[model samples]
Target chain A: MAIDRSHIGVVSEPREIDVEKGQLRFFAKATGEINPVYFDEEAARAAGHPTIPAPPTFLFSLQLGAPAKRGDIFDPENGIGVDVRRILHGEQRFTYHRPIYAGDRMTLTTTTTDIYDKKGGALEFITQKTQGVNAAGQLCVEMQVVTVVRNG
Target chain B: MVSPVQYVDTAALAVGDRLPDHAMGPLNRGTLALFAGASNDHVPLHIDSDFAKAAGMPDVFGHGMLSMAYLAQMITHWVPQERLRTWNVRFMAITPLYATVICRGEVTEIFTDNGERLARLSIGSWIDDATQTLGGEAIIALD
Candidate 1:
């Protein structure tokens, strides 16, 4: 089964989160990222940032605070009518307009941009984009996530 | 053992210079679980082996972000975190658990664009098999 093309352009509710130093530190450690700017506020300031700037790719973790709940795509009862087992991550892209600092509250808005298939419906790819804005009303990052579904 | 990002002087290096390669793992289940908790991506493909097998996948596989983290490690280990402008990755293959993956990158070009000097790099990771599990390019603003 192909992804419901009609689901394209659907926007999810925005999720708000407060960036925490300890949380970022834990992520940084788990990724084996040792940049002091991610764990030390003073070091970040020394580098001209107001607070600890999350390391690149750290925003991925923050987005989980508002992942798509069942039914949006996987809920058979009400969702886009696709099997969860057929999906795979196809691509991920991130663009940072500015560094996200510790203590910065952010709002993430996720939207599905496109849904297309390849090889006569054997493979389908869904393109989704999420924009993150800081409390100061500045754009922090834009992440594009792609989900590929295999239809047998 | 978190270390500081060391800024680099672009003039000091040549276009052919290879950035330091970060060789990581024998990645195990424990590390994969820790990454799942840390990244908040509890996707069953990376955490639930039975679920993955049910989905026709070979047990549970590592998250693509985990390999990206390895790429980030290669970058931050060599260049200061602040100097990095953009890094994007394409998931080429599944990096299975317990496989040692080596992240490698080489400076391809350094040029001036719109008053900003940037270095372009061809980055990839090798996972035991001859083929790379992940590959992509990156642009970093120079100091």
Candidate 2:
């Protein structure tokens, strides 16, 4: 089945998240980041950050905390109805306006930006754009994700 | 010991300069499990061999985000994290289990935009056998 093209331009409700120091440390370790600013508060402070700054790409994890929109293309019942097994990550992009500290609170919103297919419909791609805004109402990051579904 | 924060020397930088290579893993199940927990990406395709087989894959594989994180580490290792203005990657192939991935990048262009010096880079991650698994571009603010 084709993805619901009508779902394009749908915006998700704002989802809020607290950027925790522990999560930042864990992510830094898991990714083998040797940068002390990502783990040590004193080092981060010395480096001129308010606290442990989030590792690059850490926001991608936080973006997942957003509440799933109804009729999401990934949904099996109300949307594309494709098997989760067939889905693969296709692309990811992040544009950062400023470094996000662990103590910050962020409000994230996602929009379905595009839906298309390739290889004669054997593959389908769904693209979503997400923005993270700090409590100060400043835009902190913009993330774009593309998910590919193998129609085979 | 704390590593001092550092930035790429913009004045001496030139197009075709290479960023230091960053390598991680002969990625095993433990790494996958840890990444799954940390990244909150608990997809069965990445951590469950049976589920992966059912999905037509030979075995469980690493998450694309995991590779992306490693690529980010590569960038931050060369320059301070705050210098990153934009990062992007396209998943070109499935990173197989136990593959040691090396992330690499080259400065393709350098210019000033809006008074901030910036560099554009061609970046990718490859397996030991030289298969490119992820490819993309990144733009970083330079001093």
**Cα lDDT computed for each candidate against the true fold:** 0.79, 0.86
- Candidate 1 per-residue lDDT over residues A1-152, each given as its tens digit: 55667788888777888888888888777766666776777767776788887777877778875555432555565446567677777888877788788888999888888899899989998888888899989998888888888888
TM-score of 1: 0.90
The 10-residue segment of model 2 chain A with minimum total lDDT is A65-74
lDDT of 2 at B60: 96
How far does residue A128 in candidate 2 sit from its true spot (Å)? Answer: 0.4
Error of 2 at A116 (Å): 0.8
Error of 2 at A61 (Å): 0.4
Kindly list the per-residue Cα lDDT of model 2 for residues A1-152, writing each as its tens digit. 66768878878778899998898898878877778888889988987988898887877888765545553555665444557788889999999998788889999888889989998988989998888899999999999999998886
Deviating ranges (above 4 Å) for candidate 2: A71-73, A77-81, B2-6
lDDT of model 1 at position B36: 92
Would candidate 2 be rated incorrect, acceptable, medium or high by CAPRI criteria? medium
- What is the C-alpha lDDT profile of model 2 across B1-143, one tens digit per residue? 64854556767889999998889999999899999989888789999999999888999999999999999888888888888999899999989999999999999999899999999999999999999999999998888
RMSD of each: 2.4, 1.6
Q: How well docked is model 1, in DockQ terms?
A: 0.62
Residue-level lDDT of model 1, residues B23-99, one tens digit each, is 88867887788889888888887888899888878878778888888898788767766667776777888888788
Best by TM-score: 2
